[model samples]
Target chain A: MPFSVSKDEILETVHMFQMQNLDIRTITMGINIQDCRENDGKGTGKKIYEKIVRYARDLVKTGEEIEKEYGIPIINKRISLTPLSMVIDGLSCAEVIKTGKYLDKAAIEVGVNFLGGFSALVHKGFTRGDLALIEAIPETLAGTERVCSSVNLATSKAGINMDAIFMMGRIIKQTAELTGDRDGLGCAKLVVFCNAVEDNPFMAGAFHGPGEAESILNIGISGPGVVLNAVKNYPDSDLGELANIIKNTAFKITRTGELVGRVASRRLGVPFGIVDLSLAPTPAIGDSVADILESMGLERAGTHGSTAALAMLNDAVKKGGAMASSYVGGLSGAFIPVSEDAGMIKAVEDGALSIDKLEAMTCVCSVGLDMIAIPGNTAADTIAAIIADEAAIGMINRKTTAVRIIPAPGKKEGEWVEFGGLLGRAPVMKVNQYSAADFIKRKGRIPAPIHALNN
Target chain B: MEESKKLIITVLGHDRVGIIAGISNILARANVNILDISQTILQGFFTMVMVVDFSGSTVELAELKTLLGEKGRELELEISVHHEDIFKFMHRI
Candidate 1:
């Protein structure tokens, strides 16, 4: 038969748009700021600001224009740059903080919501610049509104950097204390990654890798509601059949990303990058990845079969997305950020989900320990151990994983800490009270897995 | 040239008289040519899909979308106008 969209199919898609929350999550313009470096730190910061503003001037406008034309809601216009640690090689921590201020200012000027790549990749070990940037994360994040920071501490090939992980735990705790007035909001803007991808268009982990083009455009598409609605239609279907349905739905969703990415790239005059088909959730009812899992015969999310269900969902999403787009990279899987998803928040509140369950779930999902809120009394070393656990998972599996947990200062377990907007409210879930201080203090690099010997 | 500017306009609302007349009148006044039209009333819910060539229209696509949106609000209908490329790209290879 000739290829044609039937009326029913068209109506279904319309329903997805009108009722279900199907929208483009982000259109990230990756601009290289490596050339903006100067001999003087101040001069380099100014150059970086000017370069980003120049490259991303039309980014927000272009995104808005496309949204109006295509009738698709593009939620965020963002920018990612070359990692600050690399660009500010010889700069001090003060200079790096200044650079972050410039980046925040540029993002505000360009009208983008967030700007990423205030990052350091120390999967093996930290350079001087990397250590300085990591040390300044608390002050940098507290000082800037739109700047996001990430530190990659492990990779399958390079092995886990236990030193960096330990340092990040302390940095995360300090970040929380620095922004304690807003329920440790600084921690929400920071992510700890293992096997971090270069062209990821999502925050708080997106960064421009050295291998990337000078400038490029990447798209992230969101549609957990669409998938959940599709799954609900097949109550009696087998797991294999359910996977097929999700795969088909994901194909359609990724196609929209491809279309939007091409148009955005053409309009912005930048090379088109990947369409990251991640099932990112929002704090709206029915717009939840947890709900999708719950729809597949689970009593609730965080139950026993949840891991297997999430693994299938993640794999099927990637398989379908890979087939739909020619360049499907980034962390293209289901994101289980608790605060961002209404279902997850409810699950946590109802005692159906806990920190341990979320950690287990992360083994199969895209990111780890994401948007989780714990008691303020949780020690720095415990947070470090949490990061170490997540890093180990990513290192062993050879997949990208990250931790974006918040130790809500003074908040007890079951209490709520609201970050507002897309960084939604999170209930402070209980973390293990036992100490890992000694284990964390004995830090060194964990050797690379045997799988890394493939080359 | 006109075919290249094809747009699919979908109108969804409770069944009512003059729904098509109201839409077609605006299209004719705007110098937009209707290439194909299909509509159905299912369970008292009126749904209409129209393919229109916007190359000949006087106003920009953005302006037309706003006008259609206002008309939709007045008629208590949910009207969406999307470029044909979206459907073609999604359904085809």
Candidate 2:
């Protein structure tokens, strides 16, 4: 037979998009804005705006073209720039907010959904710029429509920045209060990360690092529904067999991402960065990471044995994704955001998933305490304590973790706060009554773990 | 092997007469060359996969997709056209 694809293979790929929701989650263009810096903050802001509008003007159009040609839905076309703290270093807080406005205007003009990198890296200690950026985060996020901010407050080698964590807890609350009219929607776009990766294509934690090239295109592949269906197909198969099926499904999914990334790179004339093989879930019914866990014999996502199931699923995804793509980078594991995932939201509402259980689950998966809405009256110190816990996990385990918790102002526990769209809606979950004010106040550093001295 | 410009057109729906003729008519009008075709009734559903070279086609891929989509709607079938590269990348190394 003349080289031809088998019928099964063709149908299998088609069914993934037709019935199952298999789509590229994001096509992020990482642009280094270190060159946009100037002595005056206004000049820096103007240069950054012109540069982003010039560089990413065709990003959304190119994404749409690829989606049309390849029949794959490219959900969001976003741009990530070098961490803004470095660019805004030595600039005043007012200047930083003006830069954010310029960035926001550039994002809207370019037609991209979100522009990331209103960020600071103070994992070890705070620089003047990092402090200013952190202080301006609430105001910037509250004022801008599409500007996202992230702060890398901890790392395995750098340990946890307790002072920054405390500051972020206050900042998170301030952001919530600033955007209280929208139910703390500003916090939805702010992420506090531990061991944050530079090439991460997902928001609200995507930021182009200083180490990245001038311009690179990174692709994040999402196929939780496809994997969930695969797990459901082999109901009678054992766990090992089921894992193999998931790996194979992931291999195929990553291949699609690899193809799309290559095509986008070629068309955009930007170097292809990496395929982030993350199983990012959405608010859709079947597209859920929690559903995959439930299908794998768990009664619910947060009940007993959930951690073991998530660990295995996460490992299998990384293994298969690694084999499929040569240049695999970013947070390439399963993302379990509560509001964004319908199954996860249900688990929380049904009292099956708690913040404590979510913390345990994050140890095995990717990210931490994502899109969780807590009571408005919950202490800022409590939120800082949660970040400290997640940062400690990442520091000891040498994996990326982040906290994107929203303390919806005026919302009590068990009440619903709707952010709508991809940000999704979340029920305010209860937090611990105990305070960690004293502990949070004693701020310095947690010191890097023993493994940090590997040299 | 040189990269193939072939597109796989898969039509999946209830079985009906003149499905192939209708699709082939569109392809022939566009000067497209059909290389191979495979059809089977997969669990009471009519499934057909056709490999066609579109280099000689008169229309662009986007226009062809729209035309085939319109034809598919008329035939009450779900039709999809994909470049062979996607399959090669996924199934092969």
Candidate 3:
């Protein structure tokens, strides 16, 4: 054949873009900002702002160029930085909020959508800076439009930090209240994680870990629509055959990420990090991971056997994606954010999905309790208990899981809480009336698992 | 370097006259060299895929894409120009 790529292959690739919504979800530049630190917290904000603006100046332009040249849509260009606590060690709460403003300004200046890492890692316990950043999260997120915050409250090695979990419960409630008029939109920009990955390209959970290089570019690939179409094309395939089909589809999708990442890295002069194999969904129709599950013979995403289907899908995705890219990290599985995926929203509205069921689904997927809306009256203690439950799963399973639940202030169950755009909207779901106040108040670290002794 | 300047242009629409002629005219004007072209009609739909070397062109890829896009709208056809790397990366190891 004289053609390097056959006509069918070329048309198939084009059909994926035209009909299947395959896209590079994000090109996240992780910039280390330790050099911007100051002992007095005095010129730190200015230095940080200048540093980010300097490093990520051409990020959006580069993303647009790639999108144009490759004829593939790159939906987001974002930046993540070294966890804020380490950069602002011993800094006051005022300094934390100031640095957040600078991050937001830098992000706006660079024309990127979001800037992550107004964050802290307190898996075991909180330092002064960590506690300050956590305390300032509600105000920081409310004060700035594009700054995202996350707190790591647990890890398999360090076990669950119950105290941090309890504090995050209070913080989440406050964040919702802070942006209550917008249906607790602030909570949508905040995430609490267990076993948090260092190079996550997705937000509000993404933060450049201390272990990363000076600067790196990570890619997040999105193609639930592509996978759904692939699975739909093979209605009669057996489960094993279906898995193989999904793996092949994922291989093609991940190659897009690998190609884009390499090009963006070269253009930005940043080290190529990893291709996140997560099938992140959006509010757009036909782009739902839930839809992919539904196409796999499930009536709904949360119905029986949903977990098994999702487990296979997630495993197949990683297996195929790992082969296509040398570096595959982050929460590299299917994300089931209710508000973001129209299929998931419909499932929740139809009472096919519940918080408890979502928690269960989390065990087999990359992230946990994502973009869920609970009743405004849902107690802080209950929210903490939810975090504890998710953290326990991640700890035992040794996988990354996160909670980005919003308690839409003053909204009761069945009411809609709209965050609009990519954040999407969700119906306020009912939470347990029973209280976990006593358990939550007994705030101390949950000891590391027995498996921690292996190393 | 020549390989880097190669592009694959695809035109898809209902079968109509002057589809290739129109595209080739634009490429000829822009000095874009067509290396290979294979087109066919299936189920009354016309599909054309062309491999063009832009190494000899004075116009930028973005400019050519815009010109083709405007022409595509006028002809009621869907035209896309993508770097050759996109196809090779997705379909090859």
Q: Which predicted model would earn the best DockQ?
A: 3
- C-alpha TM-scores of all predictions: 0.98, 0.98, 0.98
Candidate 3 per-residue lDDT over residues A1-455, each given as its tens digit: 44589999999998898889999999999999988886655478788899999999999999999899888899999999999888888888987888788888899999999999988999999899898889899999899999999999999999999999999999999999999999999999999999999999999999999999999999999999999999999999999999999999999999999999999888888999999999999999999999999999999889999999999999999998999997998889999999999999999999999998999999999999999999988889999999999999999999988999999999999999988899999999888899999999999999999998896
Tens digits of per-residue lDDT for model 2 on B51-71? Answer: 888889899889999999999
lDDT by residue (tens digit), candidate 1, A121-197:
99999899899899989999999999999999999999999999889988999999999999999999999999999
Residue-level lDDT tens digits of model 1 in B1-93: 122477788999998878888899889989999988888997889998888888889988888988888889989999998777677767778
Clashing pairs in 2: none
Residue A125, model 1, lDDT: 96
Off by over 4 Å in 2: B1-4
**Model 3 chain A poorest ten-residue lDDT run:** A38-47
Rank by lDDT (best first): 2, 3, 1
Candidate 2: tens digits of C-alpha lDDT, residues A1-455 = 45456889989999998889999999999999999988876789889999998898899999998787677888999999999999889999988998899999899999988989999999999999999999999999999999999999999998999999999999999999999999999999999999999999999999999899999999999999999999998889998998888899899999999998998898889999999989999999999999999999988899999999999899899889989987999999999999999999999989999999999999988988899999998889999999999999888989999999999999999999999999999999999998899999999999999999999
Which whole-number lDDT from 0 to 100 does residue A131 have in model 2? 94
True C-alpha contacts between chains kept, each model in order: 0.50, 0.58, 0.67
After TM-score superposition, the amount by which residue A239's alpha carbon in candidate 2 deviates from its true location, in angstroms, is: 1.2
